[model samples]
Target: MSSQRRSYESGHKPKCLVVVDDTAEWDRAVYYASRWAVRVGGGVVMLRVIEIPDQNQQWLGVADVMRAEAIDIAEQALDRASGRANGVAGITPERVIREGDTIAQIRKAIEADVDITTLVLAASDGPDGPGPIVTAMVRHLGSFPVPVVVVASSLTDDDIDALT
Candidate 1:
């Protein structure tokens, strides 16, 4: 096993799983996760879930193209989040891409990787309120094996600096 994974599995460190999205709101989660990893001698897993639409597949080629587009978007989100996380000291972030229900994929990721000790999320504070995924996670908190930490959408640079 890799040193980081070993440390994580041995309880020497606690890995943080940060759900990343293609929005500036996710910066808070990334910042906090990176800081926590730096403090705990662990690493961060930046996960991007491509939520496939629940629509009837009438055309196979169109469905394939849509799936490809989703993958590309997910990859871009992961790459951007990775860059942000990498800026923090002592943090080496890994990216994980998944397709399906957001909550289900998150659960699968945690189950697949025993190293994850905590889940981090960035919630929207706008008029729409916290998005559906965040709401769902909140409602199903008891089902999660790892502790969940949510970052408010309104946090400013000073707030982030203080958090780090």
Candidate 2:
């Protein structure tokens, strides 16, 4: 076994990888991830990747502006996630932003960095109706180095109100 895995098994803080898409469901996802991280005595790393537009598109000017806006939106979402996690009694989450295909960037970051032990993702609403973000994660799952957890969108307003 790798030294890192050994260390994790010995109770070292496991790195929790969270992929944040700027969506309304993000708050619930953050809350779920924070709860799990606290349970495992792990720290969270939240990532938001800015997906570049395809070259076939003619609106390069608009694409550039959109890209910048997307990055800003992602950063704000991640910041909110981190703040919510920090509000939890035993959880602290570190946030990161990257530019590329979301799954590819996430995989590269996890492989290049040695700390991450488990990946956490929010499940798509359903099959066939799966969105681009969900498709990306599923496509790249085979290449991931650690276990992946898909948090159910089970937390309701009652849960959030309770947390507050």
**lDDT of candidate 1 over 1-164, digit per residue (tens):** 11123334445556789888765678888888888788667788888888766566677677788889999988888887888888765456888998888898888888777788889988888888786668889878976777798889888756866776
Q: Compared with the true structure, what per-residue lDDT tens digits does model 2 show for residues 74-115?
A: 878877777877886456577788888677788776775466
The C-alpha RMSD of each candidate to the native structure, in angstroms, is 4.0, 4.7
Best by the lDDT measure: 1
Over 4 Å off, model 2: 1-12, 54-68, 124-131, 155-164
- Candidate 2 C-alpha RMSD relative to the actual structure: 4.7
Clashing pairs for model 1 are none
lDDT of each: 0.79, 0.69
How many residue pairs collide in each prediction? 0, 0
**What range of 10 consecutive residues in model 2 has the weakest lDDT sum?**
1-10
- In candidate 1 the C-alpha lDDT for residue 62 amounts to 78
